[model samples]
Target chain A: MAFPPEHEIHRRRFGRNIGVAVTLALFIVLVFALTVVKVTRGDPMQAFDHSVRPELAAEEAE
Target chain B: MSDIRAYEQPGEAGFGDYVQLLKPRVMSLVVFTALVGLLVAPVSVHPVIAFASILFIALGAGASGALNMWWDADIDAVMRRTKSRPVPAGKVAAGEALAVGLALSGIAVVMLGLAANWLAAGLLAFTIFFYAVVYSMWLKRSTPQNIVIGGAAGAFPPMIGWACATGGISVESLLMFALIFMWTPPHFWALALFMKDDYSNAGVPMLTVTHGRKATRTHILVYTILLVPVAVGAAFTSIGGPIYLAASIALNGWFLIGAWRIWRRDEAMAEADGYATEKSVFRFSLSYLFLHFGAFLAEAALRPYGMGGW
Candidate 1:
């Protein structure tokens, strides 16, 4: 049996490509949402202090 | 150019092959130990950040696995156990594995630094380097004590996870490191005892291949004996509690018994039972690690209610 044409194969796989893109986009969105929640709901200063700033930055900010 | 062009075909690396390159089994262990490290720390981390940090740590582990596969493709090709691996089996190209490893290593380290602390990121980087370069490229092919030294690479994940939360190292994390580092030799040597032919065929100098099964068995008992103090001692640390202490005692007791049994067995008896005791010990070692780490998590879970720790 003969396979589909090369372009036909490519056209058929476009759906999968779209699926991959959508999945990737959703993951990015989820990460961004989590970051936003963490920064806003959690202690933004404490997070920033521990991860980014110098020692005792949270106390200094307080 | 035409002749060279004819030699290459588009590689058929499926998603599974990519995952195989990551060595998901090893990554799962890394993730578990790292999670324990993060959770058991005294410092509180934002839940989202904790999750992100573990994700990056797992990725760093995967990167190490991929690079190891890329570098060990030659040796892997000859070993029955690893001959069918993605790189050795011709499912994935060495260059592609290297690229993926390098890319993920960079992403995991930098993103972890942003999400957690530089110390954790630095530890993760060193883990990848130690596993990929120091262990796979150098020690693996050099000596019988390869696993003994290379075990440090595996031992660092929990320390990295602890660093993610605490932003520094502590005695507790060092004890966890010691637990894995000391446990690695006997655990692997037990398998080496069973799979001696694989190492012999591959020309890899496992303790079993280099020093013989008798010496390997003795070494297993010695390490297991040494491991007893480290495991029991962790019970007194900040991460340890009543639950952890109980788990450690039970686990180490069984582990010691298993090691002792393996030590006493002659090659004839092992061959008669098809190395049943060695196999059992090998399998038990896995649960030994899991339960020990699980105890850490249990203690962490109990701490908010004030039931954990001394």
Candidate 2:
């Protein structure tokens, strides 16, 4: 079978590239949002303390 | 110019070529080390934040790789080993690589700063700069000790990872850095021993090219000897434990034996056997890094059960 016309091929390639770039950009934005929530509200290091060394968590709690 | 033009066939660049520009092999190592660093740290991060932080750090690594490819395209075009890389092969344009690198660098840094702390983000930024600007542009062509000094760029991942979790550097993180740093010279020189011709043809001042195979052999053994203590010493750190100590001992023993074999072989013997010893050492070096880092991951996993660390 023959391929599509040159312009059609170009359009397809352009569309694919743009789609990937947009997906990646959106993912980065989501990560940024999650990160802000983690920093401001979540106990990022609390899990670490309780999980790695329970004594530290008890100390902090006391 | 003509050499670069040789690879410039009349075809449109593909997305895979753009991915190739990121040097996924190098990026994978960066990601793995950073993950180990984060996991083995004393503080725990939320799983989501951990995932995002690793992703951003990986992007930073890929960004540096793209920039290095853009800058090193000229040498890469001439080197047999690197001739098929996206930029050097003309599958991707240098300007395009620069744009991708800069864009990713900014995104990864800003997002990491938001997700983690400024210290981790700042270290990531410095790592990118050191690899792209300091190593690729300045050290690579200028010194035979390029891999020695440039090794610092690759050695920063675990430190950066630990910093992401704890927001500070510690003895544990520095030990991780030291393990990678001391491992670099021997690891790379083993490859150079087999691929000296590529460096010579590319006009890069590799130790094997400048110092000759004899001195390169000696240097490999010397660095390997120096690396042993650092590798063993890390087992005593907060991030280390019995499993890591056992793994480190076995791996270092194997590595030293390989280095000894490499040191004892002459040029004629190496060529006669097709550089078998050198090639084996080079292949082994890859596993060496993976296993050491894997041990750290194991220790981290064991810690939750109270079986890891001192």
> What TM-score would each prediction reach against the true structure?
0.88, 0.88
Clashing pairs in 1: none
* Residue range A1-62, candidate 2, lDDT tens digits: 99544554465478668969887798977767795765677453454633478766787898
TM-score result, candidate 2: 0.88
Instruction: Rate residue B95 of model 1 by lDDT.
Output: 99
Residue by residue across B19-87, what tens digits does model 2's lDDT show? 788889898999999999999988988887888899899999999999999999999999998999988
Kindly report the TM-score of the first chain in candidate 1. 0.55
lDDT of 2 at A16: 61
lDDT score at residue B138, model 1, on the 0-100 scale: 95
User: Mind giving the per-residue lDDT tens digits that candidate 1 earns over B1-310?
Assistant: 6534433544455566777999999999999999999989989888888988999999999999999999989889998899999998887899999998999999889989978889999999999999999999999989999999999999999999999999999999999999999999999999999986898888888888888889999999999999999999999988898999999999999999999999999999999999999999999999999999999898899888989777
iRMSD per model? 5.6, 4.6
lDDT of 1 at B296: 88
Clashes of each: 0, 1
